[model samples]
Target: MRENSFEHYYTQKPSSSLETREVTIRLKNGNVYRFISPSGAFSFGKVDKASRLLVEYAEVEENDRVLDLGCGYGLIGITIKKEHPDITLFMSDINERALKYAKINARDNNITAEMRQGHLYEPWQGYEFDVILCNPPMAAGKKVWQEIVNKAPSFLPSGGKLEIVAFHNKGGSRLEKTMKEVFGNVRTTIKSGGIRVYVSLKF
Candidate 1:
């Protein structure tokens, strides 16, 4: 069974057995994060495996402005800021509770992130990101998924990267095609279990 099902993950306040659990995450690249699990982010979470994989593989440069789109509990944004220190960080989520958790997590981790509230990239209408990392909500259905692909490019500066991790079963192939149409090139950077990470540049 999927521990973090969309039904459970979609709720702003999750009342799951996994709720209130805390997990210590030590990144391979030498950052440590203590995350409050089932905090409307991941079930049984130290770090969701996909998230761990994304951070592990992607190179986070110092001073790069990053957007953690669909930030959940702010694990990704806070971790990047804490590690690099100089990188600009922004996090956004449609669920208000998710944003609340992100802020709490940031404070708990002693990291600062500009928090935005909106679906996907709506909060940053005119600005561009140096790097955007997303673990998109495929279960939000086709229209929502479509919007994510369609709008992702607008958030990037010329040559900026959009990186996404998605389950292999969740129309990830379709997403790849859509990303190519939007960004001109899309390629898989890594794959493990049923998740694949795709990176593309906007130019």
Candidate 2:
């Protein structure tokens, strides 16, 4: 169904306004991109802080299949492909507008990637990845957050890293426990910047 407006496609479903705005992100490499922003989507005006860090430190290897969960506008996926040039990318988002922009940015950046619109992994069922880079939507509340984490592990291969970054106050500690349940080890990197990146391997 074509959504009327971005009433947080994740939360409510649709809005009346249907207004579109321009959201620009300045990447770490000084590359700037502007995309049509749908109202009521997460971080509708700017690049989210936690996601900024995810793209900042995202690492890729040749031919690695990378998944960008909650990939708003394809920033993480596009950036990774630009830097690495050989990694495969798959972008998924709940917001239809976000997914639209992801495709737009991918075209603008000349990156070939598979775009999937689904709640977490519904689109990639039975598919495995070498890396999963996600800035999860913790603001959606606990149940939703757990849904994302619980389902993310099945997509990762053994020794593959599930790179997740989130706002420090938004149940960051709690996520570590969930990570441990799926993966034996959960390492936190950059815990001092009001954000944390939890790197977990599915053993």
Candidate 3:
């Protein structure tokens, strides 16, 4: 595995040495969560800025069926579930190490969520969600992110929303364009520090 390769984080069986660490993130909703992060997962040290931005801007409703696609260490889904306990949350990731930590985080937080290990949308076939949250794997390249934007509408019902966070210079514009083409409308909910949160409704 190349150093800094995002694909390494997507591996089903990671060969990297395990270095477990704890991370506490303060959310926009004024709630703080502590999670255990292993070395092989994405953002092992702390919650990444894009995920923070996504959690800040994305809307989660009570009783909403939510999917946190590419959930790394369960930050986005766990935080949302923490705030909206009535919602049904499903978290999926390709990385086994990330999924293990996500499970640990969910248990530690007393949050009930379905955690699955698979590529985007694979584990949720024939299922749909009222809202989908993602801090896309930008390091995995545009093809992966574009697939996420393209297939999102199929997994969402009418009026369902898909929210994503990406850096402005690094595929953000392209993702925004693809989102517009797919969802018919794309809105920038938040943009700061070179990162933008783009949201689209499946109307």
- Note the Cα lDDT for every prediction shown: 0.77, 0.76, 0.89
Ranking by TM-score: 3, 1, 2
Question: What's the TM for model 3?
Answer: 0.96
How far in Å is the alpha carbon of 21 misplaced in model 3? 0.8
Give the clashing pairs for model 1: none
lDDT digits (tens) for residues 1-203 of candidate 1: 34357756665555644455666768876667887654455434556788877776765687888999888877777777877899999899876666777788888888888898776777898888889898777777777767877887778778789888888777788888888998889989999998999898887
- Model 1 regions lying over 4 Å from their true place: 1-4, 11-19, 38-46
Query: Which runs in model 3 stand beyond 4 Å of their true positions?
Result: 1-3
Tens digits of per-residue lDDT for model 2 on 1-203?
22332235564344535566666668768977666656656666567678778877765689999998878777777877887888988888877767876787788778899998878888899899999998877656678778777877788787688888886676888987888886778888676478988888777
TM-score of 2: 0.86
Cα RMSD to the true fold for all candidates: 2.6, 3.9, 1.5
Q: Write the per-residue lDDT of candidate 3 for residues 5-121, one digit (tens) a residue.
A: 676687777889999888888975678888898887888888788888887777888899999999978988998888789999999999988999899999999999988999899
Output the worst ten-in-a-row residue range by lDDT, candidate 3: 1-10
lDDT score, candidate 3, position 151: 94
The model with the greater lDDT, 1 or 3, is: 3
- lDDT, candidate 3, at 45: 82
